[model samples]
Target: MVSSYPVQFDVDFPARPLDRLTTAFRIIVAIPIVFLLAALTNDTVQGDHHSTFTFASGAGLLFVPLLLMILFRQKYPRWWFDWNINLLRFSNRVTAY
Candidate 1:
């Protein structure tokens, strides 16, 4: 007897070989995207020499805003909910990559 799983996975591979240039500069090419992805999580890139203003976002999730809206108004605004939902989705994509 055999047990069955709830889900199945599969992938289709291209017959041709992978491109060399993209493979070589993949990291460099992905740098911009990484930065943008990080923004959703409030990632700040620090450079040499300090300045008065900083753009660092709170770690991981943006909870403070959600908490504030809920506590003060007793409701989670649609925009806030949407932002969080989309952020979670983008985060998953980055991890899957």
Candidate 2:
């Protein structure tokens, strides 16, 4: 019989020896990416990235509109659900990296 699982995760280890110096400074080096992820996920208030960040409500990650649609309208838009799924996948990918 064939397996029927729907999702899977796999990670490959590095082939060469890791550098201790870089490893020690990994947190410092990862600042940019951490900030990027923060900007993508966090919904900031007044004066914070008022010009640069344009994502409203953190790129639909919270899905409050979708929740309202489901609660009041009794219907869920497929596109909104897909958007949430893709965002989650992207988040997972970044964390995995």
Candidate 3:
């Protein structure tokens, strides 16, 4: 006898073009701001160059992804779509427009 339980399933949805580009832009801009704030706070607490440099390095590392994302935003719309769709899982029933 089969149990009368709700089954779980995964949905395959395509990401929208604008959503992908916007997300990449937001991430590219936000990472540095976040890391900078954290580093500055740590530096204030510890009064040392170590945390400052650590944060700076992190910001530098983030720049590459930011630049790459900006450059490829148009070229890799589909890839961006996949990334964005995974990032923003809206309800399928929701209608916008």
Index of the highest-TM-score prediction: 1
> Cα lDDT for residue 29, model 1?
72
Estimate, for each residue in 14-82, the C-alpha lDDT of model 3 and write its tens digit: 675456777678767766656544443323234566653333443345556766877987465465557
Badly placed stretches (over 4 Å) of model 2 are 1-9, 42-56, 59-64, 71-74
RMSD for each of the candidates: 5.4, 7.6, 18.7
Which order, best to worst by TM-score? 1, 2, 3
Candidate 3 TM-score to native = 0.23
lDDT of 2 by residue, 1-97 (tens): 4558887656788899999887889778777876777666756455655555435546656567668888998988888779779878877867865
Span of ten consecutive residues with least summed lDDT in model 3: 88-97
Which residue pairs of candidate 3 clash?
A: none
**Every candidate's lDDT:** 0.70, 0.71, 0.50
Top lDDT hit: 2
Local distance difference test, candidate 3: 0.50
Pairing residues by index, what is the TM-score of model 1?
0.55
The predicted structure with the larger lDDT, 1 or 3, is 1
